[model samples]
Target: MRELVFALEYEPGCNRVADALADHPDARVRSLSLHATAEQLWRVDHATGTPDALDAIEDAFLTSDYYADCLATEDCGATQTTRVLDRTDDTLVLYSDWERTPSCASVPHIARDHLGESVLFETRHEGRHYTWRLIHSGEGDVAAFFDALEVAVGDCARMEMLRTADTTASVGGSDETQSGLSPEQEAALRAAVEHGYYESPREVDVGELAEHLDVPRSTLTYRLRRAEEHLAKQHVADERLPEDPSATR
Candidate 1:
């Protein structure tokens, strides 16, 4: 699953920040890693959530009136909101050329130190996008936050203009391509594999498999529907059926 953990540089003692986000109908903040001057919030969301969630959150931090007014607008260049072109959390420590600046310089190092484990997501400025890493205290699905950032940044005036002007470039397809299958669907596919249900005359019992998994049979059926959709759309070959059964039957 796609995930992110960004350290939003916010004012000290601003409870409203988290509150404002968690209260959003489309987005919710799962947890927050806070300190005196800044707080790093972790969020996760289902792949089915709206397209604008992550952009919104990014806008709040990048275009914050407090920070923008302090820095030279010229250095700001063009702000862009790149969607989740790709995301990964592996054993490797990925670095980026967007080094720390006077305003955001300490952020990367501090975030790395505070949250040892991190995952980076590709972001776009106008349409010119780059990669940014998010550090986390521990492993948590922070896809929710990234989705929010996408929504925030998409609406951001400065960032929107940057993207429109071709200042940002993305690497891959949109989130729809990135989303493979839901967790429930995956479980069903696994059950189908283990139970050997798709075989010949000696077919496995769906109810028995559902019982083994401790899920309702109907739930399993629903999962199978999703699995079939993914498999059919992706043109994944069904492994259990070795031959065209209708030809023989």
Candidate 2:
């Protein structure tokens, strides 16, 4: 099984929810899972900053042409999902299943549809784009997948591939290569590594790193995630590249 993790950026012009998220700098959507069939169940996590931002999101979602249920929420935000349905402002009747309706063409929905039988993992929205991580049968059909996505977005947005890799085995016999990091990400990840943070939950967490660095916890979290992502991408790319024939020189 070949697994690929790619980041898909959605601009405001693409979809309503994406636009709402862009308006709120701190707001983000983390895709938990998507079960597609007669009726699609989209499980997602949402985070917002101010009351106005929250209100905007609610307006876009609750009034949407589907059944939505709020499962949980806290200071950070909430997690929820919408049952798949296709409705418009002009239509007052509601359909219980997607067969009777047009269907909502979301990024997650489109990507999952394109992949067909492949398994899709958790999808995350950092700030600008929604990151989708999935595993496929290694058919190598990335170009075709993006073509479908572009059509879904309707020329409103385009996707940028941040990272992709095959997870069947270690490409270079190691998880990561000798790559450098940005100043901020380096500091945060370095501190975690110093304490064996990745070693079976042995040493420390982000909070400890924050305390040690005298920086805010959120700041540290952002830096560490980005840094780790960079290292991981490098690892995948390096493993896929052909070996150097003149290394002895």
Best lDDT goes to which candidate? 2
lDDT tens digits by residue: candidate 1, 1-249:
223312232222222223234334344322112221232222221111133544444344444433311222234332322233222231111111122234331322333433343433332111111113332433443344444344333332111110111113232112212335544556677778878877775367789878988866645654575468667865654555478879889
Off by over 4 Å in 1: 1-179, 236-249
* Number of clashing pairs per prediction, in order: 37, 0
lDDT score of model 2?
A: 0.53
- Clashing pairs for model 2 are none
Cα lDDT of all candidates, in order? 0.36, 0.53
The reply for model 2, stretches above 4 Å from the true place, is: 38-41, 46-50, 64-114, 171-249
How high is the lDDT of residue 142 in model 2? 64
Task: In model 1, state the lDDT of residue 23.
Answer: 31
- Model 1 Cα displacement at 153 (Å)? 31
User: How much is 86 displaced in model 2, in angstroms?
Assistant: 25
Error of 1 at 31 (Å): 33
